[model samples]
Target: MSEIERLDLLEKTLGRILVAIGAADAKVAQLFAISTGMLGFEATIIAEIHSFSCFTFLFLALSALPLLFSLFSLFMVLYPRLDGPESVIYFYKIARKDIDCYLKQVGGITNSELMDDYARQSHRNAEIASAKFAWLRKANMSLFFATIPWLIVVLIGYAAV
Candidate 1:
């Protein structure tokens, strides 16, 4: 097929992948929310039964919900850039020599320049995507570390009561 056709196919495939990633992310977020909510309810019940301060349970619940949500949001924001469109664009540029040659042979000057510009844009997009991915990773790691303390607090409270 022609270069244009190939690029079009790539774009379509990238779009589908992005949509699928989005759907998966949404499902994960929903499940995380539900689990966190259930855990909060259980903790609340335990605290009430033990006659401990309900504020402890409330604090745990309040913190857990937002932490889980933030993780989901981080994944959503980074997934597309890291694994979807930006990745595809990066690959496309790697194979761009063939595309440029093909366009030149076909006497497609305007199309050629457009593709060149797209490749450049893709490079910039990939860089930004990489930075975002790094940020998300750091955030995730921080959340993981934070969870340890939260879990310990809950466990201690439970053991005491």
Candidate 2:
């Protein structure tokens, strides 16, 4: 395809990827908040229960450990996002600088070469971003499943007490 067409496609791809990243980041944040809040509440309940009975506290602690781990896994889920694909930003920065240089080149040349390079880098960055998100997505799913046992434990612990 022509440079202009390629650039257009690259821009669209970048936009879509950025949107996905934003959505996933928001979701991770939301789930983290919920998990932390629930964990906090459970800890408080266990503390209160402990005041009344050592046996109950021990039982609840046993049950709550997985939930705590689940929450830990949830925290782990954010690592990819925190690390994110630096290549994308790097490519964009390079492209911006190249673009400026291209504009200043002699004879008002429309540098299709740099545009091609930009397109290539953008495509590469998009791929890297996708792979990163795929891993993040898996981690998020694992976190979701992990919470199930925690919930069950919480319910059973409360019931037992």
What candidate 1 gets wrong by more than 4 Å, as runs, is: 1-109
Q: Local error of candidate 2 at 25, Å?
A: 1.4
lDDT of 1 by residue, 16-129 (tens): 544544444445455455446545644664564455456665656554655665565556554544232322135553454476665464464466555654555545554554
Q: Pick the candidate with the highest lDDT.
A: 2
What TM-score quantifies how close candidate 2 is to the native fold? Answer: 0.58
Deviation in Å, model 1, residue 65 alpha carbon: 11
Task: Write down the lDDT that model 2 would get.
Answer: 0.55
**Each model's C-alpha lDDT?**
0.53, 0.55
Clashes of 1: 0
lDDT (0-100) at residue 70 of candidate 1? Answer: 52
